[model samples]
Target: MKSEDIQIRDPFVLPIPEEGKYYLFGSTDRNIWGPGTGFDAYVSADLAEWAGPFPVFRPPADFFADTNFWAPEVYARGGRYYMFATFRRKDNDLLGTAVLAADQPLGPFLPHSGGPVTPESWSSLDGSLFEDEAGEPWMAFCHEWQQIGDGEVCAVRLGADLREATGEPVTLFRASEAPWATPYVSPRYPDTANYVTDGPYLFRGDSGALYMLWASFIDNTYALGVARSASGGIAGPWHHQPEALYRNDGGHGMVFRAFDGRLLLTIHAPNRTPDERPLFLEIEERDGRIALAGRTSE
Candidate 1:
């Protein structure tokens, strides 16, 4: 199937240099708010065409989470692969991120963290793995706006094995900190308007600057924004970009380099249920910031 034909959200692309292929993963279950089946990934030599909706993860019969499986990000480390994703249980409204592991990029990934690594009480999602200069692993995730009036992007220290959180989570920044992020008011709670923060992915620029790609609403439309770490680390005093990197009613983006060495940004477009499709845009880093070049050619 072509990438345009595949319906996915919170798009994540993992480039396997060894196999000369890219594996795409995201929120694939049709009923995202209800019970989730699992995660499916697509493989492609180029970004345009894909093959197989390979099942990378399937919850065991005794799984704790019965709904809301979202944002599966695959990271290769030390000859093994780890998947950071979000899941929630019907018994409790709280949502959190968990770690899953497998031997291959596309896999029957099994739970590695025992359960969600994020705090049991705090609502969170979109856990992304990053290793610092000292080679210590960290999980960057969103503290959802649903619980707090303002959503936040935070990081927690991960154990060497990447199965557990070793330290308390530190707030990197809030969604309202970005000039472009707008508040989303729930109709059910007319008096309470919340600023949303979602999908936090860290990228180190060629110039050695650390940037975070995160999602929120801008002018009532889903948008993607960039934040720079002033301290040049994940545990940063972050500076938000005045404008959004994308504001076309699409978001939850991540960056990856293609096999050809071109920098590409992938996001699910239209921001509507079932109709959403992964869109890849060519991007360039200039002045230690990110700028969209345009959509990749067919």
Candidate 2:
């Protein structure tokens, strides 16, 4: 199926240049807000034409989480492919990011990290893996706005095996920190003004500058925004750009270098269930800042 024909949320792409293919993964459940089955993936040589809904992950019968499976991002490390995803616990109504492992990009990824890597008490999601200058693994995730009035993007150092967090989570920034972010006025809490921060993906520029691609609201509309790290590192005095990269009811994006050496980005559009689809676009970096180059594959 083509990208337009597929329905997905929080879309993530893993490009294996050596295999000449790109594998796409995301929140694939029929109803992401409710119960979740597992996750699926699609493959493509060119970004437009895709191949399969390969079952990359099917939770075991004894799996800890049974709902809210979202944003599965795969990283090839130590000759193995590891998946960092969010799942909700059955016993308690809480969400956290867990680490799953597989032998290949598309595989029967099994629970490798025992269970949720983030703190069990916190409501977290959208775990993105980042390697620091010394090659230490870290998980960048969000402290849900639903839990805290001001949603926060936080990071925790992961064990080298990617199974557990070795340190306390450091709050990188709150959604309110970005000038472009607006308070999410939920009908459930009309008296409260809460800001949201989700999908913290890191990118390194040519000049060794570090930036983050994250999502929040702009005028009550979902949008994608960029922020730069003043210290050229993950743990930063991160500064937000004055404007959004894409603002039109679409967000939760990641950046990648296409096989042809072109910089590209992928995000789910419209931010509505059953209608959201992966959108690939060309992007350019100028002096460590990212701007929308334009849409590519539909």
Candidate 3:
């Protein structure tokens, strides 16, 4: 499929320098809000025309989740590829992030972390992997505002094997804290002015600063923003930028360095189904934060 033809959300790109290819993964279900089939991926050598709807993960018969499969991100560790994704339970309808495994960057990934590493009681999603300066693995995810009035981005230390959580999740920040975040007006919950926090991704700036990219609403449009870790670590007194980085109808973004070493930010635009397509924008790490430089042709 051509890069623009794929209908996907929460777009994530994993570049393999050795393979001379980039693997694209994300929420691949036809209608992600309902029942889900599984996740698919596409590969590109030049990020232009691509080749796949590769089945990277199809759940086994007895898999715990059967709906709302979303945002699958792959990371290389210990000579293996691990996929962190979010799923909703069939039994209780609870949402959480779970770990999956595969041998190659693309594979028929199988469940690895038993189930979710997030707390079973909390509604969470969009788990992305981050290795701390000391090499401690952590999953930064969102605690859904459906459970709490203010949605939050939280981080939990993961076990060395990346199979489970080793400690309680620490709340990094709430959606309302972002100056540009607007209250989500949902008809389902009429009386509440709840805010949303989605897709928490952590990365180190060129100046050795810790930065987090997350999404929320600004004037009811899905927008992505940046927050710098004041302490230069995950356990931070994080400070939000004065405004959003990209306020267009696009969000749930993650950053990857391209084959030529240009920094690219990937996110699905329009924030709507079927029409949503992966949008890649050029970004650069300034003194301690990221700024949009331009849009990528591919």
TM-score of each: 0.97, 0.97, 0.97
Clashes of 3: 0
- In model 2, residue pairs whose N, Cα or C atoms come closer than 3 Å (at least 3 residues apart or on different chains), thus clashing, are none
Residue 219 shift from truth in candidate 3, angstroms:
1.4
Candidate 2 lDDT over 178-284, as tens digits, reads: 98889988888889999989899998866778999999988788899999999888889999888888888899999888999988889999898889999998887
Can you tell me which runs of candidate 2 are displaced by over 4 Å?
294-298
lDDT of 1 by residue, 132-176 (tens): 999999999999888888999999999999878999999998888
Q: How does model 3 score by TM-score?
A: 0.97
Candidate 1, position 241, lDDT: 76
The Cα local distance difference test for each model comes to 0.89, 0.90, 0.91
In candidate 1, how many Å is residue 36 off?
Answer: 0.4
Structure candidate 1, residue pairs in collision: none
Residue 222, model 2, lDDT: 89
Cα error of candidate 3 at position 21, Å: 0.2
- The 10 consecutive residues of candidate 1 with the worst lDDT sum are 289-298
Candidate 3: Cα lDDT at 268: 93
